[model samples]
Target: MTPSRFLRSALAGLLLAAGTAGAVPTASVPEFSDWPAGTAPAEVGRRVAENFAARSFQWQTDPKRRYVIYPEICAWYGALTVAGLSGDTALRDRLYAKYDVLLTPEGAARVSPDAHVDYRIFGVVPLEFQVQGRGDAWRAIGLTYADAQWGNPVIADGVSPEARWWIDDMYMLPILQVQAYRASRQAKYLDRAALTMAAYLDKLQQPNGLFLHAPDSPFYWGRGNGWVAAGMAELLRDLPADHPHHARILAGYRAMMAALLPVQGTDGLWKQLVDKPESWGETSATGMFTFALVTGVKSGWLNAKDYAPAARRAWLALVAHLDDDANLAEVCVGTDKARKTTKSDDLKVQYDFYQARPRRSGDLHGQAPVLWTASALLR
Candidate 1:
């Protein structure tokens, strides 16, 4: 079945369970009729999806890694999502065909063997294929990564051995497990994701509601917090309200959203160092935050009257950064959290490191969130 069909069946099941047709809950999809001329969700979604479809598989260029990196996997997942949400069968088929290559021996070689958070996140693509009515093979391949993440005998504080308390894991870990739950309807996957998020919240979330890059790294790095926002929003979309961790996760998400409201650039972008006025506006973070806000408003976690305009403004501003080729500009290059040293000058060095990072166009980090935002708008 197509994604639209799957959605309809899911909704039908929900309605049947409610025992009254009038009691059914539905998510509202915002119409693009009133959006700016060129920034409509459909237009931008199609452009980015086509750009992705036309590209060759991307691998890590630095250190010359052999496997496909997480950013490309993320972009691929987003394209698949927008394809399904928009009911673009041709785009859907094209994406599936691309994924089919990875199932082959030659293509499997491109998949990483490591269990690092970045590598494990590749599972999200195949699990997404499974959600769209693909075969069990996709689920099997996807679950191997998800299950292995917890395979270590020494999990600490209910967190995965892979957990490093880096804010990026906020999105990396939970999204994979959540997709696992969606495919299998297994409580373990959801439990793992929810418990892990709660732990991260306790470790990293700040009084200002944004996350630091790490517990010791004091600055609010834009993409790092973006990961937190997107991850929470994705988990909430599927997490049952009665679940033990739901309220905590919801409170964390709302707090982050409230914090973001005041910092959005007048141009609708957010800066690389989110709290620093002098930091350059960054595309990837803006896109990720837009997805979070759009998801929140649609899910009624946030009031439309309060968040809808911000979401719309963000989408328009982000699309304006996309070049004719559909590549987003002013994206901060891939960043690693700074390690605190004994030197007293360390904090300033770390802060300058973020401020001085190179801005590139067409990075998968930037590309992925634009597709994510589009998918959220359509969802």
Candidate 2:
């Protein structure tokens, strides 16, 4: 079904609210047509991309910490490589150095139990570099990282390999698996990659449609589901139509997406609690979903005209949150939803700490979302 175009309905209201407050002369949405060329899509994306890039650093590492294996760094690299292609070779070089730590002679990563599951590094990075259309080396750094981390199998610190969570296995690992599968034409890597999500797919179900994190975890962290959705978006490159599981994978993606449609907030963005509806609006998750849903529809895995408006509305809502520098604001920082049991990072965040906090427009964890959102807007 065709969706209706969004009326610039919120523009006048927002402008009026700003007028009485003696704020900067805010323009109505209708006046968006009259705005200078500086606020175009490419420019905003460029600005946010620049802001996100500046924060892009070695995760958990500084000049003082020295270098070490970090999964979050790989996540950063997966998106960073695409971004740096235009001019950020310096940032790309930083990722290349990190990838160098994991690549093995066997053409796969050498992940250790030293860190978490960052399995999808393979599908996103190219292991073998061709020299002017010659010399393709199938040495896979993304896969090698996965193995090195999983090989040692850490269980004592807090989590264990047997303690399976779905999203990481589904999205992070499959990206690399598909990348390897395409390069080697080996069914084994693809098979293992396909199996990674089985546990999660089998276990994930919410009465309203959004997939829950794990069997025991009920709170549906928006970004958690975003990872799964984005991974599915990336998987289209490798999975063939006749592959045994292709149909099922698509089915699962739609089921998860269907769960998202009903919960979009009136402002055109999703709430912090996707299923909870009443939770405050959150940009990181909303932006991610907006990216996935739009990309999914464009890919034909979802219906475009029907869903893109929500994406557009959410995107329009998202546009309003930017600062003069085009940087984003009010995104939630990283937190583990599984740690709901104790007074961990959650309750310890006292108002004393909150109220006295430095005034800022961005958070560390919002980097990926900004990157991801720019990708969506640019598309």
Candidate 3:
């Protein structure tokens, strides 16, 4: 057998022998059906999914030079998954049609050719399409980006060439690689994600179970940590229990969840700067945390009694923030890591930077997590 294939076979044998395969529950235990008005998972998911389908592609800069940005990719992926989970074929078809536009000459010109993490995450939408049985073409296209992530000869700390310790990469990088594994059933893709995650957990996870924006940036930026929480939940959902890195990944996920439980606001939201009482409630991080918590409780990775209520509270609270147009409010604007300006500046400067970020309604960054949380509830 080929080396990769042989390794996969060996892992399968180990899983079966150890009986850890299928040990983790894949479905929610309590089946979260008791949502308040306008808060039902399916109802909210469809609203957000439809919103994404009807919108024009978002861009980082000039509309003329537009390429699919990561935020759009995130919302698109969430919409596709929600369609499949809710069994809404019409919604799925609409999403597919939207993607088909990307294949046209005009649309193809808009696909970003950059090798950066944000650009590379565009691969996830196609990979999700492949998993939904769209076609072989998507699998082929998606793998190109996944493979290119590792194509650079230079490697840092034995992870992907794209690995930067920025907490956002925890979601951006792993979700793409995990989706590639789902589409292709390639163990290498899964291994790459696990290794990358372990490296991040070792470097970024703080003593309090939260993560900093970066090594030098010591503040608990909520959206940044939200990326880590959601990424770990996504990876743990698919990673085999027998994989060498599974235990460590699970430990990290559980630790983060435990830490998040106490800090959730009385209103069921988390703030832009999570640990700061003065920071305003932010929807993107709250939605991401809700998704992670709901997934954990459903998958039996967390005690339903402890996490289920928190998850439900978070979902309801998040939905309450949604407007008539399905736009979530109070989303923190996209932020780069806050760096120290001078030797005299303390960590409060970084904390203030996060608190001062403006909030917007209907941002894809916030919308994507709502869809994801909705899907988790339904799944």
Candidate 4:
């Protein structure tokens, strides 16, 4: 996360996202009506469920280049929540039972006992708490003091400032703290959430209406910001409507959604550079943004009349971006670390100069968001 490392990571992402101009997704999008009438939501859920079940992540064997914070819990939670809502009880049961291990000795350790400063904890709890009870999460915070390590002054990547941190942590942690606070009735969780937000809002926000992905990294990626947007919505849902920051949270989401609309490619996807699509484009970011806009409407945080069309448009764009297998192409895998050292060898090319070689789809950095997006799409 040093300055040198920042440039290399940003360049690596740029190299990977640069692609042959994809065909503009001008085909008239199939309507939701086109989703076979009477097609059970569970049907699609099962498809995604099977795909997620087959994927695995074991940190011990994983390379640093492949890491993202909360692969195991995020995938399981995304699979169940997105799939379960559709009445895919069987898949839901499997997912829930699969993750129920949180209560077991092994699963609890993965999400907790150390979640106070664990980045993964922020990402994991929403999916896990939303599915199972929040009991284990409460245990994690209760077992130890929250904010013991994270509150330390800036060290990695200047993320201690607001502008740089949002794209990375906002998507996961703040809301997790809110929920943990509510369950434990501990002030520390809320205190941590508020303190993080103050730092994030101050440094990351810009008049141009983008969150600094980080000080060293330059791309204002849609998925990363979208993670922040969606996380805020989820956080709002968890807090009492009377909370002082509630209105500010809605304003932030509105700003993000407005920022997204202008940069959307004619094809409905987002460019990797976000505002500068002529330079780069990516589907995963589009999907996450689409989810946020759509969910915002559903939650009454945004008006469907104003935002749903944009959401629908982005969904069609996302669908076109996916191949037959429901994967996002040109995703800067593990960016999912906006700031980390990138070796020169990371710049190897594939697609014959159209784009870098595809990282395996099982990559947690990509699948977690994809699963989260699919869940968003269904809801």
Candidate 5:
């Protein structure tokens, strides 16, 4: 037999021999150090992404109940990127089926009449479907949602949630606007995105270039800042070079990258509390930043000499978090900057509150950003 076939057969035999009652086969975990630099992110991304697909990208579920939720839908954003790059038809088909179920005949999400900005994040997937020639209605649904967001009283001040700005909106709002712009070629979509981002930067950006979680909060939460960085990068990617505010958005992106460079942990990750040295390293933020940095370098927006090492380090550190079966570890659960677990927006969470948040395995927050980073890396 050929060496490859012989090796596979022998390994299977050995695993069987080693099995005991109810014992699962041990996975032969590969070393990250051996992975080549140029293609490491994409290679690792494929493994983790496929594992996610097999499990249907849902963490815990009732077999009978299937509906799109915000978190998993966010993960699909990354998986869709990989699908486009790798041309993996099976993966793309599965995503299309889910999108089909989520939308109506006219392409609106199936939800209560009072759906909010949170629901609008689904605007992106339909644009993906339209590219495949089956999502025309889906594209309309996404555009209609953008109209709703523009008219929402919550953003009367030109940002989400009425009064105060939150870092999380960075990921949710601009992506839809950019995708809408991509689908319809409408300047209004791009105009709305730039206006909102400019408002956010004016409110939250600190002197050193990092952003506050909210104006009332003092802590620079890692993933929150990561959201801002990633959002700015995404906007610049689509915002035309001749667009009125292109220079301003690019400036904000570079400033955030400048602040991020010095704070990265020796291990190549950022802390849960970004400026707090004692806080633990966080995977999701690290992955997001890696994605932005690599993208910036590749796009000619960032200087390769200054940022490449940081990008490479961040990528490698992110890979180290993946387990034998491709599950990403140490992802913080969904949290806001609420202090003392109180009901008010002014609640100030203790430093330990961030440091102590539970870490999860295979969370979409972490998984999605990893794929984004992988897709950004040069093959």
Candidate 6:
């Protein structure tokens, strides 16, 4: 059934199940009216980045939660990148101060060997520190994270050549792999990055060029796909022209961009469920997709005329969501996999679920990508 029909049916079903006609409260969802004019993409990016960087870098989470959380870690990366872009040394130093505890010998020791991959994302920060001539502690943590990933158990999926397929792996794994290669000049690091990414696309990428969140869970959650796009963009930036995976990765990146072009909302943002237009426009995914497209155009991997306009539109759309305080609106909080079963009675993620997911302002997931997008547009 068409998305609208399915949505109407789902809402009707929900109302019936509640045994009430008008009990469920509803709000008039706003649409993207018109985009702001004349602001350069880089400037728009700086506004978002500076607003984030100038803050205390605190998200009101528990102090203990600061050490290895993905959203916080990723947002710091964004702020750091923006500092590099805007030459905001004070902002950069503030970030270092905020996250300094994690860089200590004690903090490095806190990186548990058995920790899940999400925790290892902080490794990329240490690698960045090492590049700036910081002590070996950072490099040690990064390499350890890489080793754990290399030794991670492979799961059986008929199409994947290596381990299990998770869309989040796209962003989760690549930076460390690339940074490892940068630090060691080793092909193996690059090889692992490429092979796993290839395996993911092999199994999860749809014929139309978008990806399902996972092999078993077929939903295309917006941020999940954003991770893939943003991750591929990172990998492509570091991947060598002569490498075996270059052509395929380039093709996959371009294919995903092509798929995204036709679906951009009139407001220049993408829906929470990218393929589901009836869903609300999501800021984080929109920023990531904009960053990827702009990166592709900057790298000459995509036709400038064809892709740049859309990238600009998406960037402008993203800009509209950024409040004067620099908080991003309509960012979906961290999500888990939806049910895999195809039972007809299943309440699949449609308009309501996507819309109902929390809309927090200044979320790092939303914060980080605007920096990436700005950095991409800077070029």
Clashing pairs in 5: 154-162, 339-347, 339-348, 339-349
Residues 146-221, candidate 4: write the lDDT tens digits: 3433445355432222223445577556645555565566665655565565445445655454665555555565
* lDDT to native, each model: 0.83, 0.51, 0.84, 0.52, 0.71, 0.69
| Best-fitting candidate, scored by TM-score | 3
Best by lDDT: 3
lDDT tens readout by residue for model 6, 28-128 = 11111223563565466567666765655342345664344677667767666666667667666766666565457756455444445576676676676
**TM-score for all models, in order of appearance:** 0.89, 0.66, 0.90, 0.68, 0.81, 0.80
lDDT of 3 by residue, 276-342 (tens): 8777899999999999988877776777778788888888888899999999999999888778443
Output candidate 4 Cα RMSD. 9.7
Error of 6 at 300 (Å): 0.7
| Total colliding residue pairs, candidate 4 | 5
Model 3, residue 68: distance off in Å is 1.2
Lowest-sum lDDT 10-residue window in model 3: 15-24
Task: Estimate, for each residue in 90-114, the C-alpha lDDT of model 1 and write its tens digit.
Answer: 9989998887677789778989888
